[model samples]
Target: MKTKKFQGIVQVQYEQARQSIQTGDLLFCSGTYLISELIKKASNSFMSHVAFLFEWNGRVLVFESVESAGVRIIPLSHYVTNYNNTGRKYKGALYLARHETLIDSSFDRTLLQNMIGKAIGSLNRNYDQTELIRILTRISLGVGRHKENEAYICSEFVDQCFRQIGIRFPRTEAGFVYPEHIAADPHVYPMFEIVP
Candidate 1:
């Protein structure tokens, strides 16, 4: 049952992302999981996941809350680009976003990195199962939410990083902020496609 169409597809590579990304950048990821499909269907947006970047010891990494692994850190290269399934890695279609205002200031770099470090240390925490249900509910009812804590969702985790620095978004509700809103935020602009 082999098909010529299936063989025509090309795999992705790390260098192809074309990012001149700084130490700290926010990445909005379009996922391929079954849950991602549900999220995309609900939000009517290509993005389903959100992650933030951190540079440590000259290597860049991304930190986020994922449904399966909870809060974790992976090499930035792995975040945006494809990883051969034969190897040990997590891969997805990653789109990037950054707040130029913060990037331009060039102040508080150490403090920001320190805060992200603390959040990273909180890894292996639980992903918000309630939030997932809330997202599903919003899809059906067009309005739904549950209190957020103990477990963190992707957008919540990204928001918390800013909250720690006393930078709160205007509509700062964890359950209400979806990936689409994050991607559409005025400060966040599309960087480039990862070529998946």
Candidate 2:
């Protein structure tokens, strides 16, 4: 039997995909920072971080939790162009992905609103640095992890949002989830790499 195949990464400029980018689209980052390298090594994947997108007042915004800045939303253009407001671009590649099932189907509006509400409610909460370390340690030890319920890392935050909509990503044997896990999910497909 022939197996279903997913699309390979397509390179596209931000302006090209900007209009079509929707509320639930994903942004995956392959950062070039020290912490990014550490995460890459620990997770055994190239992608070090992940975030989701949403539109507000006709502007697309990225919603994510980072070690430096907790949960927050920033204009997608600002995020890719003047990252951290440093007048320099992000130090890595950013790719756009979509959950096929979610994007293809006509999902409930109320569910989406609830999901966005949950994410907004988490704004300014501290990034779960402890959870990140605990997850990495658990992976290293080949053991399961205990839920740290307080704050969130990028993928976990995104996972929680999807959970609000009744969609769950696959987890590791240790019951941990990472950007790589979300990237490799069968239902999610790479659309394009957003370029400068």
Candidate 3:
């Protein structure tokens, strides 16, 4: 399948691109927070976080697992326009992308629905802080391996959701995944870099 290279992807303001956002679209962020920096460094990736987009009842929602909230859904508007109600947008560069297979005609819509249901079922799951630390430590020390736990980190959660629909990002030897892994998946293609 033809794909747009990340470096050549167009940048669109959220206000202008929001209406065209679709369910299953991926949202990537390179956040400016301390944890974001740490995650980026540990993952050796430009993106620190990834989330799924769903349009529910006329509102666009972002489904993400976060350190503070675990697996939760929030308005995309709130995330981009008033994150935490601070009257400021999220501190990061945001990009929008899609998994092409999810849009293919032969791909089962029922399977897509089931995958979304599975992700929604994961709501309220705790963020795997322990796994995050372990991944960081292993990456830093160049030792050890990752083991799955009950909690979910942002990329791992998104990766799991995609896996449910038969799209698996390549896993690392450490058995861990990160935002860059998801972004680099062969089935996913860059669409836009969301701008303020």
Best by TM-score: 3
The candidate that wins on lDDT is 3
Per residue, candidate 2 scores C-alpha lDDT tens digits across 11-112 of 788898897798889898888989998998898877889999988898999999999889999989986689999988899888888887567668765567
Per-residue C-alpha lDDT of model 1 across residues 77-156, encoded as one tens digit per residue: 65444343335334446665566656667667666865586577669889988887887777787777657576788877
User: Which TM-score value belongs to model 3?
Assistant: 0.92
Q: State how far residue 178 of model 2 sits from its true place (Å).
A: 0.3
Clashes within 3 Å, all models in order? 0, 0, 0
Model 3, residue 22: C-alpha shift (Å): 1.4
Pairs that collide in candidate 1 are none
lDDT of 3 by residue, 89-118 (tens): 889888888899966879776776866897
Comparing 2 with 3 on TM-score, the higher-scoring candidate is 3
Residue 182 Cα positional deviation in candidate 3, in Å, after optimal superposition: 0.7
Ordered by lDDT, highest first, the candidates read 3, 2, 1
- Tell me the TM-score of each prediction against the true structure: 0.78, 0.91, 0.92
